[model samples]
Target: MIGDMHPGDILGEYHEEVIQLYGLGPRKVLVTEREAPYPDGRLIVSRTDTDGIITHVNRSFVEMSGYTEAELVGAPHSILRHPDMPRAAFKDLWETIEAGKIWQGYVKNLRKDGGFYWVKATVIPNVRNGEIVGYTSVRRKPDRRKVEECIPLYASMKAKEEEEVAQ
Candidate 1:
């Protein structure tokens, strides 16, 4: 499945430098105390290759991410990863989606301007001709109650990850 999806198919017009930048840049950026306001009825969508390079994004995704179309198209999805999000959560998400399964979770995403927002996200593998070519993700404004419930769980997971890394 991974072989079926060529980087050129997902990375149209972008050069290898773009992919290298994704793998080399600062994994975490400025973190602001402010939060990005999420309005109701908005959905953010994006598509990425198996390697997680963003291929396409909807208007909502651009607006919510506080990044322009040009900025996001060639960047890794992790450009919006919030520090509060645990690495283990992403590990699980990648594992699930790579296995051709749908992965859903509450995600706290960082905006380009250093603000943050929470979303209920569902990521599905895009299979063509019996092989996965890419992935599609749909995110909507998260329920406040669910966000509250996940806060402690994610915090605990983050701590565990830190402990393991320290060991």
Candidate 2:
């Protein structure tokens, strides 16, 4: 909720910019340019409903994402999507998981403080009674080489997406 501000607001204007996130309905997020380094030797884990609402998160997820358990539980997993991430990456993830297959990839995630972090994410379908009910994602420190390699590729994909949108 974008709210009215009171006096002595240190973060006043720049932090308020929000966007209706993709595939996450109308939920919005503030974005920033800062990058947060992933902690070494820590793995972040989370689970989400089929519609992508967060169901569970590990302590590392909570600490790294800067979101409390109460704040994260009912939120869309896309709440953590960084704007720098190209939509095509998520599109492929969804396609792979929806087909009941595991998908592993490098990803950039957004934190509640408007900062970003990179991770190597493995998403698995939670299946029961021959049906996939939800997804569980385990994320670890992404290889620096892969993260560096993806930067320009993702930028190109984002640019192509924007070009298509402007058509």
Candidate 3:
């Protein structure tokens, strides 16, 4: 349900500068509505430094992201962030994990090939010596029903973000 491919193919391709994201810098990225079916029963996992730079990724992560392990490692995990996602969601996530707590939510992920997918993501801080060293994320398939529930919630949150930015 979560990974079901949508009919959104590369029907349109355009470039825009994105500057609102916290970590990922302003740049042009390909956008598409195409959905890449999530590979069932496979878990996508990755580890990132305190700076959010990726340090390792599982094969499942590499495959799901349409990025090779080489391409993913050392890159910011936000590289896969979808613009439709509300900035508030990530803000909450970062605040949670930075407080050494686990954060879980449904995420819309963007693929290298301009396709998209969804995941039930769980993220935790990697702490050592009384300090946070890095973070690890484990994602799995999400319930389709839950994905539907989140759609409007996220849309409203994104609308709020847009309104705030406009002010």
Candidate 4:
């Protein structure tokens, strides 16, 4: 599970010279299957355009969501958005990714049966030749303690954003 992972637990931590050379670098953590059992947390990989339309989703993603690939391929990714999730958080996510940067955080997603699950997600902008082409995200099960801490924050943020939007 991703929650069980600490920053120090990452394998093959290395410095990227390109990032240092360009002064636009962030320290990278390389994870190997040997280091962790292929991340037991359910993984969902997707590509979305600037407008947040769903373009693609992996098989696991479709299975986990209880939606067939055909049903989800063209639907908005927001189709799975949980009402408990804060709109502000997603807003922040979009803003961060749109800037061509990565955003790492915990998210609570609703399944087809309305059951909720937690994931530690790292969202990165898919850039091509310095252009923001789209976005990709990798998510894994989050630690229970971390999810506990995030719930209230998300609830509060959701309430505030919903109130604002309602006005």
lDDT tens digits by residue: candidate 3, 1-167: 01211224234563333534474445455667688888888999999999899999999999888877887888788878887789889999999999999999999998876778999999999989999999999999999999999999999999898898799
Highest-TM-score candidate: 3
- The TM-scores of all predictions, comma-separated, are 0.83, 0.86, 0.88, 0.70
Where does candidate 4 stray beyond 4 Å?
A: 1-42, 162-167
Which residue pairs does candidate 1 place in steric collision?
A: none
Which prediction has more favorable TM-score, 2 or 3? Answer: 3
**Clash count, one per candidate:** 0, 0, 1, 1
Model 4 lDDT per residue over 61-160, tens place: 7766655777676665665565566766777888899888999998765444334456788888888898988788777777878988998898888678
User: What lDDT is obtained when candidate 1 is compared to the true structure?
Assistant: 0.77
Candidate 4 TM-score versus the reference: 0.70
lDDT of 2 by residue, 1-167 (tens): 22222223222233544444665444445666677899999989999999888999999999988878988898878877777788889989999999999999999997777677999999999999999999999999988999999999999998898899789
Q: What is the C-alpha local distance difference test score of candidate 2?
A: 0.81
- Sort all candidates by TM-score, best to worst: 3, 2, 1, 4
Q: Write the per-residue lDDT of candidate 1 for residues 1-167, one digit (tens) a residue.
A: 11111232231232221111224553424556667778788889999998898999999999888778888887778877777888778888999999999999999987766667999999999999999999999998888999999999999998897798689
Candidate 2 RMSD to the correct structure? 3.5
Q: Global lDDT of each model? A: 0.77, 0.81, 0.82, 0.62
The lDDT of model 3 is: 0.82
For this target, which candidate reaches the highest lDDT against the unseen true structure? 3
